[model samples]
Target: MNLSLQFNPELFRDPNRFCVYVHGLPEMPVAWVGFCRVADVLISPDAYASQAWRDTALTAPLISLTVTDVCETEGEAMRAALRLVRMYQPPINLRSGPVSSRSGRKVMCLETGVTYDTAAAAARANGLFESQLSVYLNRRSTGKIRGLTFKRV
Candidate 1:
């Protein structure tokens, strides 16, 4: 989908109407879908103030938002959104629980040449937050921090 067309302000001008927005990568399965007032999706102080939603949906450059439907009432929009969710089977749906990228995987510390049973164990031993360790692991670099490097084994 063309981001230029999707982000067009004119498309989200209605304040009373609810819009169903799908968030996902191009050519990949839809990761998330939901309905909200058009104003909630727009970038403004009073609206689009959800840092959590923005962090999950907008932080990745490849992620796109497509307005699939618009409804006059919230119930209609919610039903439509539920229908889409059922059809797409998005893995990122709210009911699926949090997705952990490195929870169970073994992580090897390059500096110590020792492998921990899980990322959590490695992070605990290294005095790093699991989230911080996840960031390093997800980066394209060598997953280095404080002269130590780690990799999934």
Candidate 2:
């Protein structure tokens, strides 16, 4: 019931395809992510205590049991994931012609050194897998913006 959650997204070229972890997991540890009435972000208390989490899966998506509460569920996880996405949105500064309308090809125009987070990459709740949330908010501004053009990237 009690768990700790830590988000250490993979360091691969594409941070989206990251792994997740559920900390303080008993024989059967579960990573609960939904929105908790108490804390907006609750990770497993002992999830970060594991050497495996630090050494091996440090960057992997970790879920600590200590982050759980009386009202927690996958649904709430989705909500929290979405809420995080909204909160972590970066400033969009379109620079270039109308980009395409593809999925991955669609690139956003964030300031240099600014990148999306795990939760922001996840366009929706379904996109949030385990503890690693995908960030996709800074997507290029597409469509006619006050009578402008739109594209993917």
For this target, which candidate reaches the highest lDDT against the unseen true structure? 1
Candidate 1's C-alpha runs over 4 A off are 1-14, 25-65, 90-153
lDDT of 1 by residue, 1-153 (tens): 111111111345665554444443333322333423333332344333455545645555565454445566544643454454334333222221222454543332333233334444544664554422221122234322211112221
- Model 2, 95: alpha-carbon shift in Å? 27
Model 2 C-alpha lDDT per residue in residues 63-92, reported as the tens digit of each score: 233332221333344344334333334333
Candidate 1 residue pairs that clash: none
> Residue 5, candidate 2: how far off, in angstroms?
9.1
lDDT for 111 in candidate 1 is 39
The Cα RMSD in angstroms, rounded to one decimal, for candidate 1 relative to the true structure is 16.0
Please provide TM-scores, in order, for all candidate models, with all chains considered together.
0.27, 0.21
Off by over 4 Å in 2: 1-71, 89-131, 136-153
lDDT (Cα) of model 1: 0.36
